[model samples]
Target: MLKKEAHYQEHHFLSSDYSKLMKDPQIDDAWQSDIDSLSPYLERLTMREQRWLIGHAIHDQPPHNIAAKYGVSTETVKGWRKNAIKKLRNM
Candidate 1:
């Protein structure tokens, strides 16, 4: 029963509101303004942080998945995100 409940929850979450914006090209520009606003701050991030952010935020990949891909630990990927946000905040 627990397994069935978990599967249902996972399916519901995945099926709902996933890629609602990018799936339709007409709405692709919806985020352009936000992107433009954040681009300057993003440029201040190191290339490593930028890559991690692109994978974690833009691509919606989990830190564990990114960590596995890069052969690093999940905490390290999360650290990159934390430090990147701190830098942006300080700026």
Candidate 2:
């Protein structure tokens, strides 16, 4: 499902292989450092925000299904998810 793919992509981004790919001492050091620096910020998200992010990543569920789980309107769920990601990016 689309949601599953999204989840996989997120996990891939956080995986060791991805980290190792950034291991070039000269060229990739800065990139690697940047990802490392973001760890603390990522860790600071609220639990609900984190779950929503993971759900979004999986991309399996339609907005309506996600809304049902969260007891919100589909539009509201979409908005919350979008805002959550925007906040994460800003962090």
Candidate 3:
């Protein structure tokens, strides 16, 4: 998950040397569509579960760090993530 969010955050006009691939409007639209599709599933998760997913996916925070912040074991954090993903999949 390291730098995965950073990759998504990169934009065409924001860079001095533009990425030709990101220049395509369809690529940007597809990315937005993917994000939009997750909204309903995300809404169904508990706040704790949502925080864990967003922290891992977008902030690149490791499970250990998230566990520490939430005062739970790393395994518990992992379990929460698994269950949250399962719920999202079932949705």
Candidate 4:
């Protein structure tokens, strides 16, 4: 019944690729590079957008869950996500 993407579980920071990258002690520069590239776009998101992104990507939470957390609806969460992505993209 989920309309969302089928790849939520693999999108997290602890997913295989990212975890393997983290395990490399010699990859601090790689980590820093990632941080530098992502920090600005992440900072551009509103707090609510940030929370939704974290809940979805990091915590693997669904739109319904996040909507309930904010006393909104699934569509609202989707709207927020749309705006968030637009802001990041336009940046």
TM-score of each: 0.54, 0.43, 0.54, 0.52
Model 1: per-residue lDDT, tens digit, 1-91? 7999966653342322333322434324655565455556656665446546656655578999878877999998888888888887898
lDDT of all predictions: 0.62, 0.56, 0.62, 0.61
Tens digit of per-residue lDDT, candidate 3, span 20-54: 32243433564545535555655566555665765
**RMSD, every candidate, angstroms:** 14.1, 12.2, 13.3, 13.6
Question: Which residue runs does candidate 4 get wrong by more than 4 Å?
Answer: 1-39
Over 1-91, each residue of candidate 4 has an lDDT whose tens digit, in order, gives: 3535434432332234443433445436635555445545556565556556655764578999989877988998998798778887787
Candidate 3 segments whose C-alpha is farther than 4 A from its true place: 1-38
TM-score of 1: 0.54
> Judged by TM-score relative to the true structure, which candidate is superior, 3 or 4?
3
| Clash pairs, model 1 backbone | none
In model 2, how many backbone clashes occur?
Answer: 8
lDDT of 1: 0.62
RMSD of candidate 1 to the true fold?
A: 14.1
Q: Report the C-alpha lDDT of model 2 over 1-91, residue by residue, as the tens digit.
A: 6999977654434535334433534334534455465545445444444445534553356777777876878887677677677877786
